[model samples]
Target: MNNLGFFKNPTQITYGMGAANQLREIIDAQGFKNVLIITDGGIVKTGLIDQLTRQLDGIHYAIFDETKPNPTVTNCDDAMLALKQINADVVVAMGGGSSIDVAKAVCLLATNGGSIAGYEGIDTCSNDLLPLVAIPTTAGTASEVTTFTVITDEERQYKLTVGGIRLAPKWALVDPLVTKSLPSHITASTGLDALVHALESYTSKMATPISKTLAREAIRKISSHLRQAVYNGDNMVARDNMLMGSLLAGLAFNNTRLGNCHALSHPVSAIYGVPHGVANSVLIPHVMEFNSLAVPELFSDIAEDMGENLESLTLMDRAVAAVDAVKKLSKDIGIPTTFAEFKVDDSQIDRMAKDAMLSGNIAANPRITTYEDVVALYRKSIGGALVEVV
Candidate 1:
């Protein structure tokens, strides 16, 4: 309940069928002679990289496809080297969050000149990044529109945030047509990731009126359209809604930050190589349940946004219904089903919980989360079928 009446989104958002093609115009306006395209192997396989590069008729461009799923510190440094080799005057990140995150780090390092480790916490960068263009291929992470980049510090087994307005992309080109080729599982997991972003932001203690409105709409759009997006990747309407939902969620969370769900998920993915979205899916319901104790009315609002039938229910019942709705949604769309398949041991829970406790998101969580609370949540998330737990 932040009463300060503030909102900020510095990225110039461009969305439509051929938004990726708009990159040429953006680069031209910036008068950038050389362009560095940061992406992953998957995008190269999809031929999306080829499609976009073909549009860059006058600009010299090079592709660096070395980005990883987690976007490690090494990956950032590698991308930075690639940027230097090509002397790319502008950077275009043409994939999911991983690609965009790597691009962000590369841009930061190109000008900032230091280890990505030094800028871990927030607003630590002394200089503005190189001109960055984020073209999102997926609706999740919304790295296209965020000022923050999460680079994994593999040595420490932690996900580090390099934040502040300095990292915001100069342009965000969100094209639904580009997401048409996404595999079903990727669509499902990423859609859920967007939902968690909106939900956590909506229920955050730092949430402002503007963020709540954006988050509420994001929740509604994501909840209604996620199944369709997952089941029928050909549906353009569903893709539009999902990508818009992700954009809205990103805007919401960027201002409010996230909550215990994100805080807890970071450690799981950082430690076990679980997909960030899958890790978030496993922890979100339990985190929601924990936070519902503090804000049942807000949960009721979320339940309504999620299309739960709350006609004759008390606030608490509706709050509980929100959790149930999320669980059912995950089950229906084939998410939360992966956590059981991942290798996580009970012996590791304590250490993971300790890592979870270090997250700054804990402070913004709707509930005041403790170290013990994180441990209990991890065990609860693992209770059904998580393997190798003593």
Candidate 2:
């Protein structure tokens, strides 16, 4: 009870089936004359961009749809160039996490005047970014409401985290209808990413009562609705619940931060080019198992939230059940169960582990970690085995 904590959420979040319809009014209220819509090619192909533009009739805007699956520094540079060329007074992020992250980086660099690499650590940027409006089409990566953004550095092969409260969007329009069209695999991967966010935040060393409350609710919501959202993509109820879960997880982690799973997963995506959600999905269970040793009570609570029947179990058994439940959900949702499935090999583990150690998130991990522990976790994940941490 000696922990002192602080929470701040500046983004005004609106959630519902047609939340995107408010985009024009939100923009108009802010009096942004020129707008840049940052997104990916996939979202454009889905006609979501077209729908957004139609709704934003009479608003002067340009689209930069070159954002890649794992957004790179080059993507941010190109998008910033586009923003300047268009004289965009505001940025509208119109896709998933990649799109939102790209917009945040571009906005930060536009005002701050430097490469993203210069702002890799927490609170490195000294200036406020341009106004940003985020519309998340996926149910995970709640970048819309977060103080952090991840962008890849291709030359160094690392995912650099840029963080500060100034990076949070001014507004978040979370429309569940947009997620109804997500492919089953994308739904599963993103939903599980949100789940990991909640779990990690709940057990983080920085966890506060507020963060834990939101994290536990997020876990419960995701566990109840993620399967239905994955298998029945068009179910609005499931989609809405998943969206809320993701947003809550974002709020929780935005304050408490995450744990080793996120720290390790960032490197995996940066090196192997694995999708962020997929990388997180594959590593979450193993990280949970490794971390359970330090926070058995928290893990036991997670087990109950995830619907594990722990009535007759000891605290340690309940912790094991939590990890098992995560693995089961991931498998049932068709997430790749092993790092090997993503083409990661032992040869790359050492490099990834070293990069993972540099992550600011490692500081918040419930268990204090070492390079050897990270290497071991990487090997166990690749082998699809959950063994006791060495």
Clashing pairs in 1: none
lDDT, residue 57, model 1:
87
Residue 218 displacement in candidate 1 (angstroms) = 0.4
Measured by lDDT, the strongest candidate is 2
Question: What does the lDDT read for residue 15 in candidate 1?
Answer: 90
lDDT for 18 in candidate 1 is 87
The whole-model C-alpha lDDT of candidate 1 against the native structure comes to 0.90
**True-structure RMSD for candidate 1:** 2.1
**Runs in model 2 lying further than 4 Å from the true structure:** 2-4, 384-390
TM-scores for candidates 1 onward, in order: 0.97, 0.96
- On residues 85-147, what C-alpha lDDT tens digit does candidate 1 reach at each position? 999888999999999999989899999998898898788988888999999999999998888
Q: Supply candidate 2's per-residue lDDT for 42.
A: 86
lDDT of 2: 0.91
